[model samples]
Target: MRTHNTIPAFGLGTFRLKDQVVIDSVKTGLELGYRAIDTAQIYGNEAEVGQAIAESGVARQDLFITTKIWTDNYAQDKLVPSLKDSLAKLRTDQVDLTLIHWPSPGNAVPVAQFMGALAEAKAQGLTKRIGVSNFNIALMKEAIAAVGAEAIATNQIELSPFLQNRKVVDFAKSQGIHITSYMTLAYGKALQDPVIGAIAKAHDATPAQVILAWAMQLGYAVIPSSTKRENLASNLLAQQLQLSDADMAQIAALERNGRLVNPDGLAPAWD
Candidate 1:
């Protein structure tokens, strides 16, 4: 239940999960002692996640649920309505955190408008914390400057053994901006990676576990998703697997500026 400064370090990612798959995954994760869960409007499974949480029987306060507003909802006018829709679908009064899914480049709405909406949401108790996702260093600077540092809490992005994102990570650390590493498993690509495999074997853990451990060691929150019960259980065990400094160094060398979640034109330049 450790948080990255403020947000939790380990959470269940419900990115591609849908229908009964998402429901079962959330339920299984909760039963396995997972306290954080991440979802988004674009993921199209918020309702399923909501149903699972309501049925889990865990008190609402014990869970830290996070969801995001999609890029289409970035405008000031669209912000609250989008969040309200998400809240209704999640069957919750308010989320633990709400993030701007992406920083749409050259959009008509100013960063201030979106960030202002986020602040208003926090003030109105729509979410306890407000953050951004897929924002680079420049965008982060603009966001903090506009919102004032205290208002922004985190930046969720892709961080794994292959795509290290060192510059952004270091900047975030220096600025005391928490980060949530999505695609920590690299969309199942890392499981077969030779470097990650060797490291996992050395630690007597799954590659996913090793990757997650690497992220944890760097103080970045991670949300790795899996539908199977065993995968979910094993992923949670990643918290207990500690990699040695030497192993960490070797894993660090494995970074080749690789990424698996390329959404083509839809995604902004991450480099």
Candidate 2:
């Protein structure tokens, strides 16, 4: 497994998945050798995910669990308490990484206020590392100012073959903040692209593997989610696929700034 700084380079993402679907996904992923798992407060599946982990019988040290703080608990008074609640639901004492799901809507909570509280959470052992997701360049700067660049582990964003997000990636790299690509496959949309298909055929690999390899080759962490055991098993092999420089260039040309995970009112002005 590749790791960008402190964050695992590849893992499983639980976004829209819920109930039995998510439970099976997490259970199968663990059975297939996925040690890192990503969940969020809004996903409402932490308890189910925690149950899968507990029943898996894997040692806690062998797993790298990550959970996000919902925007509703961004205030200084509520952030740590909320994280403790997440820990309770996750059935773990501390998350390997804790992230702000998204920037507060309309900046209802200033960046410093929540960043400080997040740092406090780290000091209290609520999380081993801290990060922010879906934050723009401006918010990143404010976050860096609030807690310093070293304290910020990563800036998870929506990056795929189509929406490479080079601008944000560049700034995050300049500040030594790792970038985690949430929807690296663009919700299976990239699997249907002709360019990606040809590349997959050239390597005798699946389209999903080609796209995931492209993202991992670029040094961005990926957490692709799949309900099927076959997909979960196949996706883990992406870490071993190496793309040639020409192939990387070919995939780079597929960028159209395509972003698929933007929620109205919840998403910020992306870079």
TM-score per candidate, chains pooled? 0.95, 0.97
Summarize candidate 2's per-residue lDDT along 32-60 as a digit string, tens digits.
Answer: 99999999999999999998899888888
TM-score quality measure for candidate 1: 0.95
- Assess candidate 2 and give its lDDT: 0.92
Evaluated against the true structure, the overall lDDT of model 1 is 0.87
Sliding window of 10 residues with minimal summed lDDT for model 2: 1-10
Deviation (Å) of 99 in candidate 2: 0.4
User: How well is each residue in 1-271 modelled by candidate 1, as lDDT tens digits?
Assistant: 2243298889999998899999999999999999999999999999999999999999999999999988788788889989999999999999999998887656556778899888888888899999998888888888888887566788898988889989888887778788889987777777898988988887789988999988998888999888889988998898998889998998899887887766754466665
Off by over 4 Å in 2: 1-5
Q: Give the TM-score of candidate 2.
A: 0.97
Q: What C-alpha lDDT, on a 0 to 100 scale, does residue 147 get in candidate 1?
A: 88
User: Relative to the true structure, how large is the alpha-carbon lDDT of every model?
Assistant: 0.87, 0.92
